[model samples]
Target: MTVELCAQKAAAAGATYFGVEYYGECYWGNSINSASTQQNANLCTSYCAGNNRQACGGLTGQLGLYVNPSNVVPKEVGSYKTWVTQGCYSDSADARSLPNTYNVPSGTATTVEICLDAAAGFKYAAVEYGKECYYGNYLSPSASKQDSGCNMQCAGSPSELCGGGNRINLYQNNAYSQPASEKPSVGSFSSIGCYSDSGSARALTAGSSTSDSMTVEQCVKLAGSHKYAAVEYAK
Candidate 1:
């Protein structure tokens, strides 16, 4: 690919540094190390795939590196219009502070706005390990606020701190409204209970369905029509 195209893609993904190598291959990362020292510009003699006039990289390990011009590191990601910072809190791999929902997309950088948008309907939103986003209605009983601990910068906005290892930078959404719930009944299938599910490991793995305006009743009816014994609704 061309240098401009690679840089655009990297910038869109919130990457700070990007490089083009081997004519068409593009690479992206947050930091540049000593091993990636600048080489002679003439060595990058290979032509770009998209633009034949431009040189991409050399046959050797010489890379044509470039910095994303659009990348802007925000000073703080704590507060939004209706969302306020809830201070730094402790978390664990076994028990998260906000366990209602979470999103961790691999290789995709994270920002405060991204986390807040994902947790829009929830009461709480938490950013952990710089790249992880978690949402919940209530904090875990075991979790507690710490005087100091959150030290890691956000992956997307490096100037803004997200959270340290096993820690979470929590935020509270004041405009949250609880969803209506009633005893779901569809052809003898009654409501069982609420269960936790994750992207890696699903509680109900077989014959799943999705809907834009999903409700407990619709999910139960869909499952009942399909002769499924159980149904799960996730927002």
Candidate 2:
């Protein structure tokens, strides 16, 4: 593509910078950081696919970077319907405050809207480490509220706050409706008792599988298919 076309696309997406690489590949970003360095103009010898007279980039390590003249500022996260801040909470790799989902499908630069959309079905949604999005029906028992520490800027919208290193800026969707718990049974297998589990050391490590809509019967059937004597389910 031509430089103008790439710039237009980046500007339309509210990007502050755009770069052309490997002839027709276009990349967009909100900021130009240390990872991007200036190179000699002569190194960019590859002709643009749309306009042969204009050089796009080089086949080697070179990029034709340009700033978007439009300078359209990205929309920041604000008050969402039926959603209110639940305050900052403690989180950890081993024991997360919201442990259901780690991040959204597109796990790049994260914003409050992105996290809330990913967690639409859940009661709580949290953003952490500037870019991480998490969802859960209930907060972990180990998690506790913190007075301060949720101060990191959002990766997608710098005007919004995402969370701190090990803290999560939690939000609750008041409109959420909790689904009924499933009571599944498989053949003759039944749950023996409640047991504790550790992420660092799994109780059953031979083979494992996970499903978003997993039930006890599904887990038991899967284990039976694999000739496993025991089945463990994690919610």
Candidate 3:
């Protein structure tokens, strides 16, 4: 409540302001006036807890100005339901009365965050959170653990994962990996023609580079490990 009141006053004063929670215990200022309004908002409210939500569930809401509203107010949004609250209102109908169903998951906590932009005092809009908000999942606001929402970004093919300063490998992402390297199979069979296991020995053994491998009906190999034949450097 204090923060919201302060922000409204700060905005009215024509001075950009920010509210931050530092050291998990200390609060420097409920709202600090500054020239960098947007940056401060992101640093204060858009921390890892919020950023990670983009990767878990895929939510992409823009920073709304003042389009929506909630019940009974002094023309300013209230706490608890503050994020989605637009300018002052008198009822839930006014709050839910967006020009459109603002892009977001319909849920309880989710209802707390919305973005709007009005040409006048209070409007509604869908401002993009980050450049990649559309690319990730809708993460929860409490995603600090590894099992839940992502920390930075989801662990992709090492190179594509979050942080993105270095890479572990192209495959070992999300606790997964492949063998060091794989060798191609060989059989002294056809150099051409759509082929299969036609020969008695089938052309080659699993180990013998020149011997073809045969399926004993007990060993069901992948449908496409071989043309059932072995050829030269032909792809």
Candidate 4:
């Protein structure tokens, strides 16, 4: 009751950001003011009465201001979600023509994050043979074998699994989208057919070679320069 009331009050007061503090008090602000001044997540410890799972805000003086995505583009902190597995399948034969495919160098280590980063635009992503990553719109039902088939450690992150021989560590991209009907099988990122090698695609030559180090803004800029519809991450 108190949290909602405070949010309402903040909204009425024309605050772009609002925070609930010490469980009862509410603070409204026009802007964050300074990026460096923002407190770390640990500082905000007060839980909301309405939902215990959610944090209401910080203590006194330190307000927990929630920034709307509509108002701000959250920085693309390097993160990846490990999704459910799919059966072993071939990109060229079993799986339909993959929209984009990038072969990670044999000696160079590759993580699921790196592969997914390279496959920026497609909906579905799969890592196979530990060193190869493929991106496409959807997975064909006929191509699926069994989840047990995909059991290999990621080349880069050993703690994480990639896929086994001829098998694929398939993932549905939550961020990528398509038509409602056609979207069911397909999933995630960038342009449809834009192609580039790791060094050339996102202009990762010289300094920026690792896909993990690339930011969203940098990817967008590189894609824009090529006049391509979009720039998918991996080579």
Best by TM-score: 1
**Candidate 1 structure quality by residue, lDDT tens digits, 1-235:** 8999998888788888888888878988777673654455678889898899988887789777776534534344658868999888899989878776556455346777778888888899988888888998988998899877787777765656787788888899999987767566656776666667786997666667776787667676666555444444443
C-alpha lDDT values of all predictions: 0.76, 0.75, 0.24, 0.57
Q: Estimate each model's TM-score.
A: 0.49, 0.47, 0.18, 0.37
Poorest lDDT segment (10 consecutive residues) of candidate 2: 69-78
For residues 8-104, what per-residue lDDT tens digits would candidate 4 score against the true structure? 8867876666667665567776654534244555666788776676677666555565533243322211246633334355444444434567877
Task: List residue ranges in candidate 2 displaced over 4 A.
Answer: 1-78, 106-108, 181-235
The 10 consecutive residues of candidate 3 with the worst lDDT sum are 164-173
Tens-digit lDDT string for candidate 3 (32-125): 2334222212323322233332211112321211111111111122322212322221112223212333343332111112232211122222
**Deviation (Å) of 235 in candidate 4:** 32
Report the lDDT tens digits of candidate 2 across residue range 133-193.
8888888998899987787877665656788889988889989997755444457764455
The deviation in Å at residue 167 for candidate 4 is 0.8
Rank all candidate structures by their lDDT, best first, as comma-separated numbers: 1, 2, 4, 3
How big is the RMSD of model 3?
20.6
TM-score ranking of the models? 1, 2, 4, 3
Pick the lDDT winner.
1
